[model samples]
Target chain A: MNEEKKISGIQFASLAFISRIACAFTGIPNLRTNLPTSDRISVFLIGLLLSLLLALPVLLFIEKENNRGLQNREKPCPSGIGRIILIFYAAFFVGAGILAVSRLGVFASGILLQKNNLHLFTAILIIAGAFCAERGLEPTARVSVLLSAAVLGGLLFTGLCDVGKMKLENLSQPFAGNIPIIVREAFFEACMNVELPVLMLLAPQIKIKKKTHLLLWLPLCFVCISAAFAVAAAVAGHYADLQVFPLHSLAVIAKTALFERIDDLLASLWVSCTVLKTGILLYTAYVAARTAVPACKKRCFFILTGALVFGGYLLLTANIQFFANVLQSAAVPVLFLFATVFIPLFTCLKNGRKEHKEVAKQ
Target chain B: MKILAIFLCFLLTFTGCSATVGTQLSNRLIIEAIGIDAQEDGFLVSVLALHTQQSNAANATETQDSIGQVFSAKGKSLSEAFAQIDLVSGLVPLYSQTRVLIFGKEIAENEPMQALDFFIRNYTLRESILLAVADAKASEIIETELEKNTLVSKNVQDILESGKNNGLTVAVELYQFVNRFLDETDAAYLPVIKTQENQSGKKEITHAGIALFAQKNLTAVIDKDAAKGLLWTAGLIDNDLLSIPFKGRTLSVAVKDCKSKIRLHKGDIPTFSAEIQFSCDLIEYNTDDTLLFNLQELEDVNRELQKQVQKITEEFIRTAIRENGCDCLSLLKKLRNGQPAYYAQIKDKQTDYLKDAVITVQISSEILKTGREVVKPN
Candidate 1:
């Protein structure tokens, strides 16, 4: 059903960017809304920098440990630690996918559909994402490039129309309101971007000069997300203070000479982008499943991963409040564990502690 | 597992449960405008909605404008009012096409932001809807009809647009209103409308200057000249006409263009000055003063006219600041923008800064054309 050809560097970069910033484009968190628009945007950028920095070490460790294909892990040990790690990776992917779909659900219901309609749309999306993941990375990466183009174009189109309405002076004010809250929001926002751990899991699949290509995608995503927040702040101003999805609201209010509201267009485009993002995460989950069970065939891995994800989506989303609480509590610790503890420990075990010495010298 | 995957795929495609039905055109009553007024019990909400059924198709063929009437309801909250409206209006009322939002004097003075909050929070309303305060009841303004089958909402929108062009009122859209309202000092202003009965017994609404607000209270209603001065500082002034009394008669000048720049002179206490420059073409010269035909004489007249404009605008500014305690010129914003360090020193006592600060207004007018009858001063 799919070709085995390795995707190009540009395609990988596209996929990486689409997955990382898809949610960020929705908005930076509104937790510290009292801070000036300038302070809010600055904090989000700072948090984005923190997220990137935290993710980089994990990325390097994964590349150093497994320079070859991503599918390779280890024979199931009697100790079962490797199995545990693989399972963790799979669970993280599925968990992140569930949350991403739930976010899309919130947006869709709020903008265009009823609550029940959004659930059905989410179901359709999950099944479609699983189907795409079953095909392979090549197709997924290819679709991501096209979807990235659409998402970027939609964002740019909506942003350009609001330029006349925007007051550039809105961004000139300094951090005058609340410092501690702004700092907390900055870190909380950093926790929202899933790129960090996703990249760590998919490091071996990256073929192009790892340092160069990743450098291209990561900062590109960082700047794109930061600019989106800055644009929303400048365009919407005090109005954006309470909106659940500021960027989408910014689009809803933006009007060109020919059209009244382009928000519908923007929502449709984001739906596609979010779906593509889900597909990539599902592919990552499938790869994790294969890594854990060497005896599992590609078809069997796809079916198992898809089944587990669909079931998780159904069970976890029954109560959104409970899911939100679970996600909020687990966000910081889980991110730290995968990025800091898991990466170094696994890398040292695979290549011996001497590899750590070499890495330090680098 | 394969069977499970296949079964799920089958369910996803085949067992199609229609998640939701989209709003149909026939089911929705498109709202053209909305009006809010304060009542003794709660709030009265009125909407000018499109009538779905065509009474006579042949007569309706030529008219592209939708025929509408104002349907009103009373409730404690905006949502509750909307629910009452929905119950009365059989079709679902949609607000995407709402062009004007009229606020009655009571509502605008008592609860402007709270009323505006409902519109802002409702996803159906756009940020560009024209906002105005009704000098009378908002429901009366909406229910009043006009010639050419024009909706009262459309008429109000046109009035604001044309009045802004004529320099009678300031141009304030929904976003600009909220922007100005959220400024450090809540001194945002909106155009005021009053309904008058014409000789033909038809009701005609007129935009009478601007209604200034201090927070949620309607503090004062400034006349056209003061409104023009306020607009000149904050917005564009287009097609403004000026009349100057020259030797025994009046010389009317049509303003072609104008620009204003505020240069802050920080002293022991900062003094702000506005330098306004305007270009005008003399349209009429009623005085038969023989010297008026000379170019030199016309220049002298223009110099005198410039002084008069400076005096008028300065007086308007003084009244706005002293009488109403309004920051009509945004001096605080300017100072904060230009001299941040100086602003920080006076930040603690900012509320009193406008009262104490000395503002100077200077006007410079250039005569673009003296007309065919050139005036030369002796």
Candidate 2:
């Protein structure tokens, strides 16, 4: 007597592309300048491919589960899939939230607000996002769509404003840094961008039926990648090899009669993006965990762990430099393995079983 | 009830922390000048901060001017010195608008790198703050009173900027200083300012020369002539006067647009070829020439002047690289960043390698305009 909605193929691709672009833009600038440029791009591509592999199995199985439920018609459908999806969502959401909030929050303080005001302002934003997520996924997604547009617009406007500062000759030599350095650097950058597809944990729920979905999502991902790369490449140039943050350095070069310092604006944008990004990831963690285990109350868990997680974030982030080193060197490799390895392995097993069941029924 | 109480406590704490001060305490302090001198133990820091006072209109005359307080302290560390000085001053010293950091000659020569490290490490200090070496003493230079010393900071700023109008002095900022110091192949130099007693009883600041440092350590001081030579190599010479004898008469031509490039080559011994191209406008002439000169006359003058500039700049580079072991031209950094393999091999033996390096200078000139043709004084 009830109609259950389905997420189409277009929606899946949209989720994949959007996730890729958002994460990539956030991390590539940091990765390119500090580490070897070669390592930066290489590691990012590796992580991205790995994420795709991990995501494929889960995507196909979800499709299979839908097909199986339709075919049976008589037997009650298994209720455990939501629980499994929820578990993946939980780990992903929390890990991403803690990482993004703690890392970007510190950087935002340095770039935007005065030192004393950084913590207070960032904490206010995080609290607001956490409260908003409590309302549910629909509101979160709607807000994300609005936020993502605003971020993209801001990025375009900033790029256009700073376009005159760009010297084309700076990017003359591509991958000028050492090969080993580039690979290491690429992995560091990839850590930032590749985690985006983790939003696929929400794959089962989005209503992506329209044919126009693929057209919308695929180009969006490319545009995000292009703009971020352009910003890093143009700003750093030959001097990029020397400085820590080339994009920020380029932001310093921005001179307009209206404002002498545009780096402050870029820093503010980073803060806003980080906030929405953390909120989405945190919600995903809740959803994924709830899907995997029917007995667990996901939203309640979010509420319970909120203060503890925040406290942990504070304690762990005592030393900003140490936190950055850990994020760049340790956290990225682990994230790459999970997103690229673990998910795919599980998906293959689930798909193989579903195939076996289909043959047996036939 | 407990949760409500806890929330109320948080609210009260947050509200209690709200400040009423219109401006931050740090903003109140206006640090005009910073003097760094090396003592027998460590460093002697002297800071000139703004001292504000309220004057009654009855006492205030038409020529009422603003005056400032100068505070000095010595400590083992810069932060410690800052803390010591802050105690004596009513307001905290703010360095956000700090115009100059003058280093005494002894401190510059003995431990220039250490003084640079202190500024680089401080987050509050900006990279754009001008770096200068005091010819005599840091305190003496800051205390020197000049004509219309109403805005001493503005006067110093104008002097440094005017250096760009000619090639007499070299201007270096904290960022540029640190950048060169950190860069293995390049050296940094700062303008030297000295206090001198003129004909009158007044004390004045004079630009002595440029203090050249190798690997962030002061190796030697290049006098005015040598500074002019170095500026020629760096392509920073704008109003340089070239006196060339033609037809047994001396002609002075002022340099206008200029470009310099040093290309490095390697063989049994390393070699560097320097190319400088510039345009000049005739400013003065000994002969009373009423008519405008043709292209050939200008070309001849240009060729002779090119030879003169090339001879000096080439000599300067050779002496700086071979004799002094200085890399102030930043050619080494350019080479290192442009070619890593070459840098890796020659980095250790840079001074030795530079001695063996052959340098050639080539100059090209284009005359833009000659002075107003003084009609023959008949």
Candidate 3:
């Protein structure tokens, strides 16, 4: 990557944080095992720990490879296998992008704009996301920093407004539910943090002065997500179970002496975060596509990636029941483990073996 | 060229597929309050909607009425009734601005959830909207005409808020009602509103007391004094005036800074205790005794006030819990939080557990200030 294309580690972490927190603003979605609202804080904390463990391979790969990104390392692999791996990564990014945009569409229609056309809003968001992606990763990463501040400030404002309403009785004992179900839900929750893979792919582009910045992201993400869930449970109580999006409902009721309703403004901020996450995923997909097929023009791949993501979004949302089932399925976590852990671990071992063989020959 | 093409695409997409926005403020019936009464075959739904089409000058001149107009429709369901309202007014009903939801005594007693499910499920309706029960038909209160630029909805809301502030009634919002309703061990309660003729012979809305519900049924309507006790136990009391008979005169103290804590002790049957602490300021007196400034006299008044409060609260607990079998004090919630294991064991028979449980009340009051007349009258 060129010097102009490089971003600081803080910016990179901001990108990942914004992406992860956007999903949280939508509240935990449909799952095969429904975790009670009171148990969400514990489950989310467990999920964060699991995600940290799963991210070890990616972190080790970053440590061993001397700042070479996953795409950069693809060129050194066996020829056919390298292209296939790149293609797989490209597909993963596209799938992640589709899921993010589709969720935003559903939230917009269901909560914010019940009278508006869902497809039109989604298409507009996809177009804007593609435009942002085409501007390259450096600009997107810079914007993420500003958006992160807005998100945190909005959360604090709303939290303060709702502090008096939070009841201690609303919170229940952690792990009070079935053990197997809690673990299952936690695993699925960890899988939804697609930013882990994004970080792996984008590692080379981040100019790191220290590794601590990268290590700090997981705990920070955990604190933010768990606090949000706890507040939602405390303020909304069991009524949260009836809401499609408890955070949105909380926002609807949150008021200060000056402002009667701020859900509209807060919803806008959340949607902006979703758009930023989609843009980052689209850019990653574009980069992966370029590596898979080097002969294709950059513009062609970018446009193709955008078109494919929008097409995938349409397919997923066409049948609501099937989309819900897919969300609850084990497929997402399997793919997440593959892209974030399996590939990075395999590549690290393969490179180490290659280095040993070359030394022996010398 | 690229920028222009993008701008054109944006314009086309936004203009072609935007949300319908043709309904002006005049065309929308901005609902201020709603009243639902159970009928023989269906519900008589009445809405107090703002008459936006009225000019400001006309509204000012017609301040006695016409600020809001009430529209009623009957149907088997709320949605169907609302549809009929839309037809009658030829305007879309906007529920986002609604301030209060009132249900008739019959509906509240028979099927509150059935009448409230629509508002609870509505995306546009706010969860913080004040909920109340009418003493009789909700329509009577909603349709009550008031003088001097008063909206019936605003009047009802003010009455409930004043009642809540003074510790005479417990104000319940939509979400709180639903939360308690969903908790099988807890009972839900809403402030009761009644239409009464004022001294001037004009109809006015008043806060009668509170309607207590056991699960889904309205079990009892506790009076104002009992409602105050409920507020004291629930720590919902902010400020109230306590009048105690002392030495052949009435001594009024303004109570403030009230707090309560409930502790549950587990056994074969659980025992619950509520410790309440509050501070008061001497505000009024029926006698002109100069010795009121004496330290011993203040102590005596404080003791009498504490005894009165304790007596009222204990009576409320007995009437609500033992007599009516209503868990209005949320002892079960306390049990669930304080002793989850014990709660789980008794989860199946929570009603029986509540009926058999022993409750103790402790009240403490300190006279923080005696007001401006420190020396009393000469």
Candidate 4:
């Protein structure tokens, strides 16, 4: 990738933020974590801190690899090991992308169309996402910046419209649930931060002017997510538990003198964000596949990754029962930890050992 | 060529490229209000829907029915009943514009969740839609013909809104009702509507009081005074009229501004203390004594007004909590917030907690200004 092809840190943060928002709007499928509604903010903040701690290895890897451009970096391990790692990352991104697309399909069928099957909508969104991915990271990052602004503005507008409806009586004491349950719920929240892996994969493509620039994204993302949950809890009160998508329900009830039933408009905006997230994921998968198989053309690998994601989406949507089971299982969080934390930590250790050997030889 | 292909894709996606024609607005029956009543075998659903064919100004003046038409159906379930309306009306029923949902006395008492499940589960209905209970059959209220060129649903909505503004009734929205219904510690309440005839023999919908629900059943119907007390403790009172008898003379005061705070003090059983500060302006007085002009006399009237307010507030708290065992004041919610440990211990015995819990009311009132006349006539 050329210098101009790389995106700025702000654009990268925006992409990550939008991706987290998409996941939140799709509904975090952590049914076992029964934290109180009012405790969601504190739980999410704790989850966010855990995610930041998990990203430390990736941050170290990025700083060490900063001097080496995307195309010039040497593998920390042997070529075969590097290829296996790349394949693992490719598989992880495809799985994450599939989940994102399937969630969008479920949301569309459940809320917007009120129909059982939304294959056509899902296909159209996947195709749009693939096309955006084919445009590469910089363009997607730029588009993410604009979409992030729109999403933030829409949330602020909804919150302001709902401020009068929010009652302090609706909020329960934070950490009122069992301490172990609260910790488990926070862990589940941290597991949903799949954006951490995406950040690691795209770090080489992001030009960070300062380390603090990278530090700003996690807090910003969690703040928005927690605020959204808090507002929904306050406005909807206990009624939020009855809803599959509380934010969407909140948007439905959110009315001003000017706009009535703004949920539809917000739903559209959320769909756009989901598509952008899927695009970024597909692009990252393409990058991994290209690195694993240097013989394949960039466009070919991109197309291959897109096809795989769409196929996975169709499979999951077709077998929604299985998909639901997968969401409830521990596989997703395990995969997230493996891809984001385990791999980066392994590479960081390998590089450190190699440098230590060189220093000892001198 | 790529741009052209993308544009074509966008066009097809946005337009939905369907072979069948979309349902036009005129062909769609826009439901404005829905009423549900419990029957022996099933449920009856009534809808006040806009008759798009007669939705013209000229047609509206011809008959009051032209403004909106009422349709009813019976089925084993609410979904079945609502589905039958489309068959009966020969038009697609659109619920996005629904303004109110009214439950008949039987359904409200028997099984409100049966009727509520449909509205709560339906994605088309807005959560902000007004919820009320009819004193009689919901269909009667839905079919009532008011003044010419007026919608009964709109009239009901306005009546509920007006009642809320005047602090006579609590205008419960769908979300608020569901929120309370789902909370184990809190009781749900909805404004009650009844049809009455005016002096000119015109039927009008009026806010009766408030219907309180314990869990799923309609437990009690509080009168206007009790409702006023509930509103005062909840800090929902605004511009309410209060009349006090002071030394054989009646003084009417309009509440200008009111603020309330409820605090929970933990003990073996939790106690709730409500502090209400209100300011009122004298609207009318029957007293003719010129001593009313004295500052001390005004102070005496203020103290009397404060006493009257305290009496109303305390009576409401007692009736709702001790007598009826209704936690409509959300005292448990306060306990949960202020004393979570005690709340958890008593959450299972919510009714017992309400019955045993002590509630104290404190009210302070300020008479801001007298009426336009400074002095009484000689």
Instruction: Tell me, by DockQ, which candidate is best.
Output: 4
Clashing pairs in 1: B292-B375, B293-B374, B293-B375, B293-B376, B294-B375, B294-B376, B295-B375, B295-B376, B296-B377, B297-B377
Q: Report lDDT (Cα) of residue A94, candidate 3.
A: 85
* Clashes by residue pair, model 3: none
lDDT of 1 by residue, B98-160 (tens): 888889999878858888888777755667788989887888888887775567887888888
Per-residue error (Å), model 3, residue B81: 1.4
TM-score of chain A of each: 0.86, 0.74, 0.95, 0.93
Q: Indicate whether candidate 2 or candidate 4 has the larger TM-score.
A: 4
Clash list (residue pairs), candidate 4: none
- Kindly list the per-residue Cα lDDT of model 3 for residues B10-60, writing each as its tens digit: 442332113334567777889999999999988999999987865345546
Estimate every model's Cα lDDT from 0 to 1. Answer: 0.70, 0.60, 0.80, 0.79
lDDT tens string, model 4, B1-378? 469536633532331112113677787889999999888889999999988878844655776455789999999998999889999999987887899999999999986887788788887677899999999999999999977768888998887887645888877889989888888788899988999999999888888888999877899998888888888888876668889997798888888778888888888766788899989888877767743455677788789978887877887877877788888878888888888788788878888777777778877888788877574433
lDDT of 2 at A224: 56
Per-residue lDDT of model 3, residues A158-267, tens digit only: 88888877877777778878887888888888888787777666878888886546756677778877777788788877787677778887887788878877787778
Report the C-alpha lDDT of model 1 over A1-362, residue by residue, as the tens digit. 44456777788889877876667653335533456555666676677677666666665666565643234545443127656666677777777787677666655555556324555666766767776777778888888888788777877787788876665644545555577776776676667666556665565555666554654676677666667667767766666665667777677668887976587666666766666678888777777666776666866665666666666656655665664565557564565466445665565566666667799999
Decreasing DockQ order of the candidates: 4, 3, 1, 2
Can you tell me which runs of candidate 4 are displaced by over 4 Å? A1-3, A28-35, A67-72, A75-78, A115-117, A298-302, A356-362, B1-21, B56-65, B246-249, B267-269, B286-294, B344-353, B369-378
- The DockQ scores of all candidates, in the order shown, are 0.29, 0.15, 0.40, 0.42
The number of the candidate with the highest lDDT is 3
Candidate 3: residue B289 Cα off by (Å):
3.4
Candidate 3 falls in which docking quality class?
acceptable
Candidate 2, residue A254: CA error in Å?
A: 6.1
Q: Is the docking of candidate 4 incorrect, acceptable, medium or high quality?
A: acceptable
Flag regions of model 3 displaced more than 4 Å. Answer: A1-4, A27-31, A74-78, A209-212, A296-299, B1-20, B55-65, B266-270, B375-378
